[model samples]
Target: MRANRMPPAAMQCRPHTGEALSMAASDARSGRLGFNRLQRRPARDRYDGLARFFHWTFAACIVYASVAGYTLTRLANGPVHHFLSQLNMSIGTVLIVLFPFRAGWKLVRAEPRAMHGVSARQQLLAHGVHGVLYLTMFAVLASGFLMVPNGYTFLGLFEIHTPFQKGPLTDALFAVHRASCALLAGLVVLHVLAVVKHQWIARNDVLRRML
Candidate 1:
């Protein structure tokens, strides 16, 4: 090629031209190149203290309750079986109380930072789904208490009789107890799917908040 008509060096590109213009404008506006002035803000929040505590404790309680429930199902009549069934009922009542505390705390507390590039619509959906989850958790616990035939007692400390005297109320509560469990399971799956999508598909930090 002729010297006057020669193309620019192979290293030159449109992106470089744009970057050079940006830096020049930045320098002119602020008297310095701020390109390297990036700040490392700490990852804001995994969860509030209350939410974290609730998550772990609820996991433990669920494991215990499930085991106790499974054990109760296998035995026909025995001291051990009755005791376990009673213990499970007692623990379920505690969960009924604690679920609300955890959920109410979430309502008042600000959630942790969302993953990078997560849209505002996604964030709003996250919050709305979580609200449904909280309500479902509460309903599950509440119905479980009402479904128990013998009510709940803890180490013989006290007794809280089932409010339903029988008939339709108890039957409905029992149905609700079963239905709420299915709802809760679906919610858990959705929450997990979202995290998997963010991690594997979106390559975001959604799971890092928990980690």
Candidate 2:
């Protein structure tokens, strides 16, 4: 007598059961035994600690410099106003020095991937904004340096004689510097709003990457 056999459909079902058991065993070995792969949370991309530090520090310096610049314009010409002007220039000088290091780090280190679901065009726009911010920052600082008619007294520590002559050229540069600062302020506001939108509206937690 022939041995009993399962129908073709039942035989096919048995292999599926075997496959499920095999997969479970494999998952157990890999430490994901019971979890559904589809339900697993995606991994998050994060900026390195040093990058985060650079970002926050740069932001703080920009904010302080902007506030000081605005305050200087409102104050009457006096010792207090002069001190704030000098402080603002000092902050700009510090940013000029720090920017190179930040750029170098970015060159050497790979940046984290864009947030999940962010389109390529959006990523490009983000990068373009960053490039503009950096360029505007340098332009503002450079023009400010050239605009010092008398000379620059860095934090009242030392006075450096003006390399460029005090003339209409320096006056023009001062105007350019002021305009650049205004542009920078606008860009910073936009940057903050973008982050907020991502964090709250989009629910992407993009701000957490920097933090």
Candidate 3:
């Protein structure tokens, strides 16, 4: 019986054949490349708490501004329309004040990496969209300020003087502001669709990073 039995060492080595050895080597290479490690890192699960707060706050401000702006166009010239316009302007001013601080924080903090299986091209496209959104936001806010030369009174608390006189140039600026706003609305819709695709089609739960 002892003669017939295989050695313990041979049995152990038998399980690690050529195919298994090749698979192990491939996994080792992947780990060394940081791909596997990225998936395993705990930080990939979500953004830091402060980042989440800033994201949601900005999202709320944008939604409010968009709604107020659309309503302003529908209402006839009156006190109510004027009040809504002021509210929209106030919101825009708040965003202008907050953007730099939020951007600074982003610069200092680390961002969560793209989802594990996301392609490099998709990541690049997402970033490009984000940059365009930022540019459009700045355009809308600056043009809005220029469109009103008499300055703004913030809920009757204080006033901001218009930096320049209103004329044909101001009218042109107003047109730019309107066009930028429409572009922003379309971009926002695209962003939402991307999120839905990640969550439903890709089943990635990408939005949880911000949440």
Candidate 4:
């Protein structure tokens, strides 16, 4: 062995050559295994079916109630106005029943992961909007009940008696109800616009998760 030995420079180059061969072999193996296998995208998270159901149901109710509430204010005391008033109240009653379960579900369920490229500010704004929405929703329901001038039939099933008289207190509550409803309407519009921005402009398709 002493008779056949490599020079210092040749020995250094030998190891490098071996390393290069090893790297090439590794690349070849990777190619054989398929590029997609090495570069696969992670699955996107989505809201569960029940959560989607609750979301759409609330959306529809809110839209209808906003329109009806506005119409009630414009129309004079007549059969048409009275019928719409009852219908709006019925929807509000339904929302009151569903709110607890919907809120509880949100508290317990794990939220879907944010889509790729969503900014931190976006997440903050979303949380803030959702919190305000819940607050306004509760306000709308509570004030609706308190501002009722008299006992009324709920869903044509039973009576909802208002202990509070139509005085200063009820009048104040009506103001709160109107303000909360208006705020809620604006928030809903902003929410829809955000979804549209994500789905189309940002190429995020955020609405797909809820769907």
Best by lDDT: 4
lDDT of 3 by residue, 49-147 (tens): 988887888889888888888888899999999888877878778877888877778779877867977999999999899889888978887888789
lDDT of 2 by residue, 144-189 (tens): 8888887888888998667678889998998999999999999999
The reply for model 2, stretches above 4 Å from the true place, is 1-44
1-211: candidate 1 lDDT, tens digit per residue: 6566435663477679889999989778664334334343444658756677788788778767655665676888888977887787777877877876886787787667667788899889988998898788788788888777656677568988886666788889978976887787778779889888988899876665655
Candidate 1 Cα misplacement greater than 4 A, ranges = 1-43, 63-77, 155-157
The TM-score leader among the candidates is 4
- Pick by lDDT: 3 or 4, better one: 4
Q: Relative to the true structure, how large is the alpha-carbon lDDT of every model?
A: 0.76, 0.86, 0.85, 0.88
Ranking by lDDT: 4, 2, 3, 1
Candidate 1 matches the true fold with a TM-score of: 0.67
Pairs of residues clashing in candidate 1: none
Candidate 4 residue spans exceeding 4 A from truth: 1-44
Give the winner by lDDT: 1 or 3: 3
- Between candidates 1 and 4, the one scoring higher on lDDT is 4
RMSD of 2: 9.6
By descending TM-score, how would the candidates be arranged?
4, 3, 2, 1
| Ten contiguous residues minimizing lDDT sum, candidate 4 | 35-44
- Candidate 4 — which pairs collide? none
